[model samples]
Target: MEHKDNRYTISGTDIEEVKRKNGQSGMSYNEAIEWMAKTTGGRGTAIYSDTNMEEVKKQNQSVQDYNKNKA
Candidate 1:
């Protein structure tokens, strides 16, 4: 997990590992929150608020822009 500003980014490998650990059933919402707290030193992402939403939007837009240019 990488923490910069208010964003928390977890890799697909990490998510797969979590799923594997949880018997492939996947984690519940609370389980994911606990994992984030433990893994990120208590700096869990605020799902209740708009934390990092802008960054996520910007990233998505960037990808769309890149694909448009490539095409």
Candidate 2:
């Protein structure tokens, strides 16, 4: 039942699905978004045209670079 910018696309069911899939995996929301982006072969915010695609790219890249450094 998360609402963002007056958009009500995601429902409680969706959250449950996400939680179920993330069980014992410790996947944060950002990690899920990144994984979805990689799996779908598209930028994560492709559905939100108002979002800056470049920003998403930078975020995804930053996460990857951080993981690389951490490892």
Candidate 3:
């Protein structure tokens, strides 16, 4: 599924919760992407593909392989 660029807010309570969990708050788009990739075991670029579906799938598989081998 394609990921949408949804907006998220870092409220004071949210920030405090993040701090309690030793997490960082107030991330930009790029930062969120990196965080997602790190947290979910996938690449950030997979969410922003501009190529055709088949090519995107191929690239995504290649990236997954690369990431898996790098681990």
TM-score winner? 2
List RMSD in Å for every model shown.
20.4, 16.4, 16.5
Predicted candidate 3 versus true structure: per-residue lDDT over 4-32, tens digit per residue: 43332333244445555655446767777
Weakest lDDT window of 10 consecutive positions for candidate 3: 3-12
| Order of models, best lDDT first | 2, 1, 3
What are the per-residue Cα lDDT tens digits for candidate 1 across 1-71?
55453332343345555656778677888877767765664654554333476898999999999999999
lDDT on C-alpha atoms for all candidate structures: 0.66, 0.66, 0.63
Could you tell me every candidate's TM-score relative to the true structure?
Answer: 0.32, 0.33, 0.29
User: What lDDT, from 0 to 1, does candidate 1 have?
Assistant: 0.66
Candidate 2 structure quality by residue, lDDT tens digits, 1-71: 45673323454246655556779678778776766665665554455234577999999999999999999
Clashes of 1: 0
**Candidate 3 clashing pairs, residues 3+ apart or interchain:** none
Residue 33 shift from truth in candidate 1, angstroms: 6.7
Summed backbone clashes in each candidate are 0, 0, 0
